[model samples]
Target: MHALATITLALAAVVAAQKVGNLVPEQHPQLSWQKCRISSNGTTSCSTIDAEVVLDAEWRWLRNANSISNCYTGNQWDVAQCNTTASCTSTCALEGADAQSYRDGYGITTTGGNTLSQKFVTHAAFSFNVNSRVFLLEPGETNRYQTFVLMGSELAFDVELSSVECAINSALYFVAMEPDGGMARYPTNEAGASVVTQFGEDNVKQFFIQDGKRIETPAASYPGFPDTSGLSLDYCKSLPTNFQDAEYFAQVGGYARHNEALRRPMILTMSISNDHWANNLWLDSTFPPDRAGLPGAERGPCPSWGNGPAPQEVERYYPNAKVAWSNIRFGPIGTTV
Candidate 1:
């Protein structure tokens, strides 16, 4: 009787475990959404989506070349050879009018200190595209903008002030190409107001928290809050002195341009840093025609603009700026599971 009872209990325990799903910890669980409660209004909604871990390995350096056929064998300072498409040559050049000039004066390395494993470097001058997919709940819904919220933090090491330039700009930004080949940029204010106004482009979207105060994009309109414009410059005067020293995190919550979602593969370009010829100058004097001439140009400095250029850009020009980041993550905002 004792043996039979023990066997019966073991079978019951197995059934219980099956009912509760797998008890072991998950390694890279599939990304999904679940319903969660909204604290503000006590309404149940799906706003917090699970994110994927893209760059989590320790000391994982950003790849200098995109080519899978031919590896970059040159010195650390030499320009990397990239083959972006399967049909392109091993040294395939970017397809743009200014591609030649844009590819010059840049290099990448992964043998540096201060990263997850003390090795991190920026890709060459061209954009390093981090690709990802956006989820769609249903089909047959075209023209609906798919909104994504990117959240992560990064730290800079060995940041140095430029000896020749008054200001330098480093930025991590998102670029989505339109069906017609036009591109829309996020966190557009990376160049600050003087540059944006001088170039005649709309102030891009960005949000930051510094010194316990929230700084919003200048003269920008968000999706849910259509009637409200962004915060003014006066509110962001008291910024931190050393932006590189802190672990800065940004949350850009908004819909895509022209209702275009990232359902298709999109590129997240990290223009680590760019040192301009002078303070408040755009990194490149001649803005690309495709990027310039945006609407709603505002004439003022951005509150979130760092005092120094991004550490990555600083490394590019001075080779002294050291920057590293934890893995970056992206996903939908309203997912609850």
Candidate 2:
């Protein structure tokens, strides 16, 4: 089975990077952020903020079949759907402390681009690597908060070689969350103004468009976007050569501090569509629970874009999930914009 899914993706990336580097954002602190908003005719302006994203990491089930690890279920997966299990560990520790205070208010950093180094290595050489769960947006974004959503992780396993010397590890599964709602702020404005100012220059750059790839934008001059006519990004390394372009990349730093928060900015006007692939953002389960966008027996219904299980297992393994849908923007100066 592909050498046991590359030894379970190298023992789940050395036990989830030594247990998330011995977790210490004050001993288990999810992201956080409270309020934001502003709009003015006084100087070509726009503002908005509401950063709140959290994840109390402890959900393990990358894969298990060779023998079955007793049906794993690390639970807690509520990006705001709040399924259960104590309301998904209290909405993943209050949206992981509001995505770590929207990445420390704005001075975010994960040490620049082409990421994958903590020892996993990847400048683009291509030896092999995987085990990425996404969430990386560009710095200090005002109001328009710019249509957010950066949740990743699911290469499951690859990185080969278990011979000549020694290399084969895989086993990652962790979960935890149980703090209830107590710090949910963000709702002011009657004179108590502070709608997060600072405009244009927060650019924006993030990636992870895999399948058939194209993600272009090395731009000579172009970054328009009013209703779309310029800005091109969905993958472009060079005339379609079977690009999966997104091979795990992270650049997100802790948001709005309290110990790293994030999630304030939802004006929703961001465009980049292959038509919301498989329902919307790779949903899986073989959707039969009422079927939606892509579950074709002959392409009848038309609405299984985000939850899967049909359309012949998403067209027999994502037959180009709508041309591997993509559009991720911001990138001209300083690489990842």
Candidate 3:
């Protein structure tokens, strides 16, 4: 995996209300990570850093700052508290996520020292938490997020996805983001990365799985491309994914666009979400199911009814779906391995 040495992406999102962030004694969950240095002679040294995880503002409780009434409830804004964005921003405040809140309210937790886990579906205090997005905070700082610059580096981490199954996505990636969480540009965005996005078409899509089987091999690999473990503009340009929204990543310069962005510091984000948009066929199934006969259309091993179940079906069938990422180590290209 390519090492990400930066973190910064602004996710423009549409929430039930535009409220001020996590105000009530914000408590971020603790997670351990590290930065390593590799000498020319192959000497390696690593220093573990203490970090914290903050829940995205959307999942935090939004209540009237002066009272017990919730500003937003049951998928709707309590108009009495917030009839407009200004009203909502002024009247409601997003609450903090303690470790308990992370686990009970959002189904997120840090255990075994560094591993962070996200559950696809869980019963929360108000409703079901269908998905979650969390961010990493800088060490020794309460709210400032950590950043990395990953241009000539390699980022390595162990992922537990035996339970992640189909239609559900658990992700970890970097984006050029504001260290202060965009609070300066958008005051109402008291929370950082309220809605995050980056210039990439595929994240975990390179991993081809088919019911415990990885079908794609080097016979169809890009010229001079030794393996599927890595990607290049050549591979993206020539590979036939039959993406449901086949924009041809190479046409837009693909990772090239992102590589330029990486020149600056960027923020890291982790999340687990169900794709209601296209039933997540883009990840593990033949995205445009009709194009299954296409050479590279088949993506993963799970049975595909257009690539597994839709969001609703996944919620019902795999209520316990979860993913754990840990032992994250970053440094020179080969040092991490």
Ranking by lDDT: 3, 1, 2
Candidate 2, residues 281-329: lDDT per residue as tens digits? 2322333434333222223333434353332343234322111001122
Q: Which residue runs of candidate 2 sit more than 4 Å off their true CA positions?
A: 1-23, 26-132, 137-328, 331-337
lDDT of each: 0.25, 0.21, 0.65
Query: For every model shown, what is its TM-score relative to the native structure?
Result: 0.29, 0.21, 0.77
Lowest lDDT 10-mer window, candidate 2? 189-198
| Model 2 Cα shift for residue 237 (angstroms) | 34
For lDDT, the strongest prediction is 3
lDDT of 1 by residue, 1-337 (tens): 0000001112122222111111111121112222233466655344433321111111112122243222222323124433332322223211111212122212222222211111123244543412111212111222111232222111111222233232334443344422111111211111000001000012123344445465554443422223434222221221112211122221232233312233343333233333333323344332222333332122233322334355445445544333323223332232221
TM-score of 2: 0.21
Error of 3 at 303 (Å): 2.9
Worst ten in a row by lDDT for model 3: 1-10
Cα-based lDDT at residue 83, candidate 2 = 47
